[model samples]
Target: MGMAVVTLVLAIPLLAALGLVLVPGYRTPARLNIAASAATFLASLTLFVVEPAATKWFVLDAFNIYLIALTAFVGLTTSLFSAGYIAHEIRIGKLKPLQLRFYHAMYQAFLFTMLLALSANNLGVMWVAVEGATLTTVLMVSLYRTAAGIEAAWKYFILCGVGIALALFGTILMYMAAQPVMGPGMAAMTWTELMVRMPEVNPKVLNLAFVFLLIGYGTKVGLAPLHAWLPDAHAEGPTPISAVLSGLLLNVAIYAVLRFKMLLAANGAAIAPGPLMVAMGLGSLLLAGFMLYRRRDIKRFFAYSSIEHMGIITFAFGMGGPLANFAGLLHMAMHSLTKSAIFYAVGHATQIKGTQRMDAIRGLTVSHPALGWGLLAGVVAIAGLPPFGIFMSEFLLVTSTFARQPLLALPLAAGILIAFGALVLRVQQICFGAPDGVSKAVPVAWSLLPLYAHLGLVLVAGVWIPGPLVAWFQTVAALLG
Candidate 1:
């Protein structure tokens, strides 16, 4: 049953991707995409019920099981949102019928790569999976074939190409670091084996390997300075892709970083990775905060917001304690849900208004109350407002930092406040003002359902968390240390 579940989890997406490309038309492929995503999500849930499974290619544990569940859930919701979104695009001639076949195929392929990366037991295979994710998303980003879209895709491809190459070098370095201890076999490249034997590995070489690995995966995580590709990719890609990129793909890179961080922790002589991660996280937070102030495009503005939230999550993990790590994990889940929900609302709003520019879209509440209010609720949650899941996570992070690293807490709080101002300002302009006379199509019940479902979960999380989930996060937090 263990093997069957894992196999089914992967096989569904792989088979669906191939079949989707051959299947013609819009509705059937969209339904298939949603169905495949839903089945994969259900399969991933069985990981928690079944015992942990570790084979040559895949491994499932407390560390990854919760994340796999989160990824699968978001992927399912995004597919639900995408089905409606793509149909509208086709109606307006923005996307031809045939392009959607490729789109559906690539979407599944992207999910497969992410799931593979998270579940991988071998270091080399994990790196390959991350690279595969980059390639698949690049094609999707340029699906519209516009000048801006193509440019974003090229930029995404080149920057991430360089980043993945660095990651490959880092993977080699990790294998080299392990080979001496494990003595030249598959064990040297295996994650489970490496963790078991981490203490015997040379700390100096491990230190060097970690630096390269951090930079390589950090770029994909959208850390500042290396985040050049993120905003462009988010702004120009199909909204469904943007939704998953934040909700799912970035977490894959974060998962990679945590995997290596575990190795570093197991070695007593290795340099502390916490301070370095904290520095990068702090830098990304402040940089994104100020950048949000100058943003004109709504999606780009929120893209920076994603960076800021990633920075916050990184900072919490970097603090390295049971409380901080727990907060980081919670924030990771919260941000994924809240941000993706925002993108869904944004996708529909932009469709009604016919533009992504902030100035061009106004009076949404007055004109389209459902979308306007939905977008408002999403932005509020994302901006770390009270009575929402994100606020709880951010509060925990801030308090944890104040107790352990008070000096760092000041800037972190400031960055959050700065972003809050910008988001509130921008959302107010779009939701409350006079209507732009361009809206023709109203979003159907299915589109809004997924958006509200996500936000609803987040809201519930703020006030009450399930007992089992709290226990699960606590277990993983210990493992992180």
Candidate 2:
């Protein structure tokens, strides 16, 4: 019953999204989107008071409980922002009412897909959920149907499609490995069951599975070499969608990778998943850091930053100790918060400035102080400034790496510094100048709410984490190993 509640909470938005297609009313879709998301938020809130729950189809543990809550919370807030953002787009003639309806429906579907991925007890089900999310996001990405939007969407579809197919094969391989230990049945495929019997599975197959799954999901996570599609998607998609892509989609991809990591850790004979993760993580960090220097579009610039931060989180997790895992978890949460917040500001900036080109945008601080400084704060926070959650989490990760693997720490730290330089240089150009772009007086205060709220929570967590949260993380960390 408890697990059903979690599943149902996630399902409502998706079901409503399907219902949206049948409804002819344009305004109704937006209202339905908001209501469905709000209800999911409230339903997820119930989980905080209830004990953790698990079943064959669903499970709620320390790790995913917080993730579910956070995902739902952000989903609700983003839905609210979408209401206004899409309305503005419709008003400006960029989107027709028919397209607005489609946007609302797709938004709900995306929420459902993430929730499903987070809550599924079966690994196969989780993969299906993530694949569902991929399809939904591709539609949303191409909603505008501009040549650039269509091209971006197609690219996202093809790359992610190939990646997800590999992940499915990996899942099947894991099932094959598990079947010998747990019997040739569905029980062997259950994530909870597999975790319990992990030691009994074949290490060789598990090693192969990890490689396939990592490459598959890592593409979605925007790790380097496989991240070519992300910048274009972000550059061409709606700003609200950009927020969710950076804030939620990438995290879901990482969550899938973590699941595989847990299984590898459980099988004692398998080569430690840590080294491969570390290599890929470091490679992504280094690649994104240098790539940051050449972006001409604002959204693409932050898209690269997404790759960089995802790399940092991946590296932390790859290090795999109490301190490093905790930092990785914290970094994941903080990056989700900080990146989405940056997108909120970026969305508004593009709306006011009429273009995404970095060169066309100048002196935001002179014309729009609220958005300008809000963006500045987000950039500083993401760039690892003190007093922000990102800075604290990153500090822990670096310190832990230095203590454990000093040799690897040099390149990791260098990557961060390079990324910092690129962000600061670009931000200086965007935030301070002679004020050339056309500006609007429209107050997008509501959209700013989620951005600031996330940043505030991150700051609080950095300065003083609650006792319960800390305990929860420790428990999850142990489970992770």
- Model 1 residue 42 CA deviation (Å) reads 1.3
lDDT, candidate 2, 191-271, per-residue tens:
888888999889999999889999999999988889988998888889889889998999999999998898888888998
Residue-by-residue lDDT tens digits, candidate 1, 1-481: 6667877888889999999989899899999999999999999988888887788888888988888889999999999999999999999998998677688999999999998898889999999999999999999999988999999999999989999899888889988988887899788888888888999999999999999999999999999889999999999999999999998899899999999999999987899899989999999999999999899998998899999999998888889899999999999999999999999999998888778999998988898888788889999999999899999999998998899878999999999998899898888898997787856789997789989999999999998999999999999999999
Tell me the lDDT of model 1 at 422.
88
Return the clash pairs for model 2, or none: none
Off by more than 4 A, model 1 = none
Highest TM-score scorer: 1
Best by lDDT: 1
* Cand. 2 TM to true fold: 0.97
Cα lDDT of model 2 overall? 0.87
lDDT of each: 0.91, 0.87
